[model samples]
Target chain A: MSTSSDVDLDEVYSFALDLAKQAGKMLDDAWRARCDGGPQTGHVEKESAVDLVTQTDEDVEAFIKQEIASKFPIHKFIGEETYSKGSSKEYLIGKEPTWCIDPLDGTVNYIHIFPMFCVSIGFILDGEPAIGVIHAPFLNQTFSACRGKGAWLNGTQRLPLIRNPIPPMPQDAPKGCVFSCEWGKDRRDQPDGNLHRKVESFFNMAAEIGGRQGKGGMVHGVRSLGSATLDLAYCAMGAFDIWWEGGCWEWDVAAGICLLKEAGGLVTTANPPTDPSTARIEDTKLGGRLYLAIRPAGDTEQETGRQGQERTVREVWRRVRHLDYPRPGA
Target chain B: MSTSSDVDLDEVYSFALDLAKQAGKMLDDAWRARCDGGPQTGHVEKESAVDLVTQTDEDVEAFIKQEIASKFPIHKFIGEETYSKGSSKEYLIGKEPTWCIDPLDGTVNYIHIFPMFCVSIGFILDGEPAIGVIHAPFLNQTFSACRGKGAWLNGTQRLPLIRNPIPPMPQDAPKGCVFSCEWGKDRRDQPDGNLHRKVESFFNMAAEIGGRQGKGGMVHGVRSLGSATLDLAYCAMGAFDIWWEGGCWEWDVAAGICLLKEAGGLVTTANPPTDPSTARIEDTKLGGRLYLAIRPAGDTEQETGRQGQERTVREVWRRVRHLDYPRPGA
Candidate 1:
């Protein structure tokens, strides 16, 4: 190993890749088996439907947990199914090199058979996200990244989309932009409801001419694939110019963050859209309870300095300033 | 030809299926050619940024028009690209057979290389949507239906989703709903800006407990695939519980309506929320400048009669009551 804090990075990455495929097969089989049973067959077992979790989610998570423990032995694990039951949040930061697993990132999409969901796994080294592997079995696409070595799609193409730099920006005219957000898991209708605020802001960003408050951002469009993992992975490739959301966890974004960062994309709170470089890796875990991510500019847009990525992030963020939400449960 | 209708139903259905694939291939090829070329490559020629049209759209439309003219000879055609330039709208409601082609639906999604776009072709006989075919090459799916023959997917499975009927409703509270909507092409920020009204209403359907006038439907989730063709096709299969949209034309919803009807789904004006059975097929074109579609209730879940589908439709519509938009220039 390179240092005492290090594990064999490539070896762990390979293990993650294999584990993800194994889990994907299980999930897909469950999906196909229930396909003809109608939309409700697979969606029955749930924690208040909207924030759905099925038998398959737990089955897949348990499988991955068993496999990871058998293989890694010493690594700490923080998985979505077990996140609430254990002290995994304590394992999020530290030199223990935790592994974050989201067995199924888009459960809602899966239930509806909308064909956009994936399995995401991230390896954190000494508290810094270092390796990420995301696999969408239905779409037959996989995205993975190693900290310094670069990101890859399906084992070949580089990330930040097409492994190419973003296209050159047209002068003056705000570069045509696309932003994505989610309805999220919290369905509270209270005055402090998060969705109410999100819906208002989504309208503000997507409306034409001038949006709410006479300032529509006029983005090309907005999308919600119902999966944070795929969203972050697509954002890494620049497919989605920007993906900002709240109420998702590290498991949802950890793997994607590796691919995103390794591809030279930037991430910050969905609100207060700040310079991503300003935060330390460990200390940067959703201090604002939201995340705003942008693909680096290249001709596929070029990345100049903090200004390069920040300019687009700041520009888009200006229109969505209305999305700011109060701290959860506060 | 059957009866005095003088139309060969199967022959026209075959013609539509062939033309859809031909157009789908051309669209797919153009999509691949422009994949790595940033967002603007395929979107070079456009009416506006958000409401985009590429060279492929025109080329594909022209190709379909020529092929239909040469083979069908006497058939009238209404293709989106040529709609504004000619008197095609006059041919929309006629005893003569007319082919409505959306050369490229979800143009925005296609431009972004997002994989959610397709070619939709529908044949209307005596003003009744008879033959329908929608091909999405990237997804390797083709949905088609004939008035009495029923709908099919990939040329094998019956439409209305799988070969199976709509699932029976669960005994529990509600078999969580999954609804779909569109950002649409209209960008006017005015009160007539259907999008402004849509945004406010979408929030209402999606919010929970009490939202926007203390009435939230709390649908299982919401989706915006940005493709009306695919949205309707999926609704026919019961994939999306409900899809509400406006400002879209006949070509957009025509083909899908055929499949939905064959699948036993329901379609009505989005604003007034009328009974599909009471409306004439020709008069049923989202004349209110809107459409509300629902998947047929299957034995899998029995919510009962018009009330079954209407309950969900009315529930969601209550939140969007303010979304009334004027016809075009009004």
Candidate 2:
């Protein structure tokens, strides 16, 4: 088992970045071919009607997996396509250095030629996110991070893109915040279903600031862009103030969480803490399945980045309904 | 008052394209300045806390208005910022050569540094869309069209960017469609309010194909990108299969409608027609605050583009709730 102290994180980060770009090129070529050619894009249903998988997805994942194996044969890999195929005998994150990949993060967007899809590669060691690389070929953006080394955009600009003084979180947060969320593929209408809770929660957050019978946080705006990975990347860039999501696997968010952490953002359980005052956001787990992510904050007269994030999280938690996304093998 | 036949649409289209690019440059400069500098990017609340107006918005609109007045001295102009002010004695769309401009279409996105915002310029002659141009600087996309002429991307590639044979709409209609919508600034929570109806409609569309008890369309996906103009532009390019929106004024959609029309798409009332049998999608009024836009359909064995669009519209109408956004002068 390789620990963070013993792992060459810089080497892993460079390898991950190269592999992500290669996967991105594969995705771009397939998308362009689909546009120039015909309906031969070859997509099939996965778990449900809305859930989809494409040949390009498989091809990209295979390429990334082969590259990783050839370069670092000892490291384990967990990819979306392979995991979905029921090949996860040891799916649980062990102490060994592991790689998590989502070859095509937004497949539906890709199929429609919407230009929001990307290839994400994340490396973890000692059960902690260590390096992440996400490349969006269509959007011409690449985000990468190495723990304790900070995040970068296109290997140049630093994360949060905004360089000036960061604005402090408003006292009435989730009020002036730009909230990002997604309506996942699980659309069951039952009382406790993911769809029902998501709709209720979105309504509460978007309703009038004081409405919803005191449940409204009235965040500045709610965006559903259909890609959890990109949402996290944007949150890391300070474009999205907060991102709340569930029903997504580790591949979907692992790289994003790494980027956010390196960018000085906070990640926590999507569900409210039982004891809000005593809860530590740093205790959040990678495979938790439900996550709340808040971008770095601007320092104010009284609030530090950590304090602002905690306050904003509390306000957001008060508005969102309790979602049930049990951990795998729980 | 000039009619479409008499107006030189090509000239207007070229001018509109150049102006859109200029506006986009202005927006990009202001945005870059904000990113590099501090909180000097002056902004104030408009209509509601969620609604915002920034100095760049006003500056861009003023610049566009000046350019239009100088280039086409006889043309009328209506801009978003100017319209928001109490200077609308001639706000109503009349039978004239008028330019409808949303200098900064997605102000909230611009303020938050989201990349989905754009500059939209639409030319109307005799109450009909004649020329349109939408430029998104951050995304490096420029969409333009002239009446009776095809739409283009960055002045080169023809729209519905897919050059291969188009696939006909599926028999299931919205079942496999990529639906685009928005959560407008109206957040009232009353049963008949915009927010309540929007939430209900989103849930119904996203629910399982059979779980919503005959109400579910089980659309492939739902995206809320927050910019009606870009949504319309993307629809023209065939990235978005359908765009349903309310609470957006003519400026937000005029240019997009022109681009879609030129690209072989369709725009109809967002509300379900009172007489579905007698309804003609072509008769949809531009002043109508609610709109339903469908992208160009793929050719199939049994359907043409027009037929496919009409059929898809009917299916989507059945699933979406009626939204009331009264005409400006009604």
Candidate 3:
């Protein structure tokens, strides 16, 4: 099922950037052999007890499925710790040339050493996500991309990070921006409203607009840096101007949604489909769970070395959404 | 007022680490002049508009109070943009030899580049915080300490970072450690109960025990990292075991409460006053506007190179307290 004119997207994005830097050097030599003053022990737990999984997340997902089965051993795989056992839920149908993994994502912020975990990879073909890589060997940064060649970091080639690579969203852009979200592992509270619409959308996007009682979205900041593929590669390097989430897993955002759609950034759905007359964002049904990235906007203002931003998409889903969160098994 | 035996404390912690690395190189060259492609702009605002401030947070607090009054020319200052103008509040009294600065402790995450900010300093005399420094130039990390000399980082010397550090708090530990906080500039919702006890103590410390209904703190992760001196210097380099805050300012916890009491932790108060009588956590009234830190514990068991951990202080303040927060002018 490999498309993009019979696969050759720079040799599958240089073999998914050398198997995501060989699963980030076997998770940096097994986190310097059991955390030499960093991670701590090989913490092991899963499917409950605050959901964690370590031993360097099943030894970097069995060395990235044994180096992609010794270099494309008839592709097709899905990782998140051996396709997350039990109660059956391994998605992605039909699209054969696969290899979606989340080798170490944020294993509970890598058993609490917490340096914003990573090492993601994506490939898939006819079913979409062409090629992508994300590495964060302790924030060294490496987001990559293919299928029309755009998203790149730690290797930009495009001089001076494109005169202004990814920083748009500014039509009076929610005051000072830099939103991000997460708090997953569903701890449903309130009359059970996804922790009361995530504490009422993080206190109405960080209160103000007449200060408290003002139904806020005064967003200038509200991060939750416990990785969602480095929260969509830091919202595709616009350094987070918004990131909404929900019970993730398409190996935790198919390589940061291909570096947030090759850094032109938008990606939606923190709850949509409110009678949009057959609402269709390509028939929204993503399973890396409800997301809402945003960083690149549009309405015709961003000029200098453009690449994204003018605010539309119905003005950033009417300034940061949450279309009545609290779904799952409703 | 310079007593700690006439304060030489390693020459005021090497002149507060060369004035916090010269205010982190003049805030990394005024954040590469208006964030070329990073933070986006000057974000001109002060006590509102998402409570921000820029022009490199008043040019890194007038270059860290002009290099600490040109190297301590008879010290005494308090700079959080000059005692945060208007509504009078310049704390730290008697025995004056102060210096407490903040300069750019995450100015809304440095106008939203979102790289947890820093550049703290401290050096009170009879008023205590003998000397400290915190750097974090885009997280290169600095953290310093003095009074009786102990804490350090990015200068880890004193033998393999104190012969293998980053290990404190064990007492049957597995409750998934790491916890840090901040949603500052108060957006208090849920009938303003400190944002409903911070979303009910982050959904009862990230719910579990019979799911949701059993309540939580089954914690293993929860980071906010907008920067309170790099969240008490990443909870004094143990990489966040706990950190709590409150409206912040004694130049942001007088340089992380002297690097969390020189990294042997515990800094109390999210509301401490249910006395078994004379509450003496150094006469708890920390005006960096409420803290909580923790890290090192004690109840005996911790031995060998022990630095702080035996647990008891009413068993670590009844396991991470917040005492139904909602205080500031309740």
Determine the iRMS, in angstroms, of model 1: 2.6
Encode model 3's per-residue lDDT on A1-330: one tens digit a residue.
343455666777898898898788777666555445454555656766567787777877887888788877777888887877645674653456787888888777665555688789888676667777988776666788776677777665321132353444555545457778877665545463665566566666676554445546667778887888888877676667777777786778887787667766757576644542344444124453677766644334544312233232333344343534343333
lDDT of 3 by residue, B70-159 (tens): 876677778787677747664544476778788888877665555678888888887778778888776576878776677777676321
Question: Candidate 3: which docking quality band?
Answer: incorrect
Q: What is the TM-score of chain B in candidate 3?
A: 0.34
Ranking of predictions according to TM-score = 2, 1, 3
* Residue range A68-173, candidate 1, lDDT tens digits: 9898777888888887556334434456678888998888777766668889898888666899999988777888998798888788766654434354332321
Best by TM-score: 2
**Tens-digit per-residue lDDT, B1-330, candidate 1:** 222167888888888898899999998877665545533455553445677777888999999999999988788888888885563344344667788889999887776667678999988887778888999987788889998887787877665543354554323212267778887656567764567678777776776655556766667777877788999998886678788887677888889889888877888767743543343332246334578887767543344634566555555555665455465432
Residue B293's lDDT within candidate 1 is: 84
Instruction: Give each prediction's DockQ, rounded to 2 decimals.
Output: 0.49, 0.80, 0.19
Against the true structure, candidate 2 has what lDDT? 0.85
How do all models score by TM-score? Answer: 0.87, 0.96, 0.34
Q: How many residue pairs clash in each candidate?
A: 27, 0, 17
DockQ of 1: 0.49
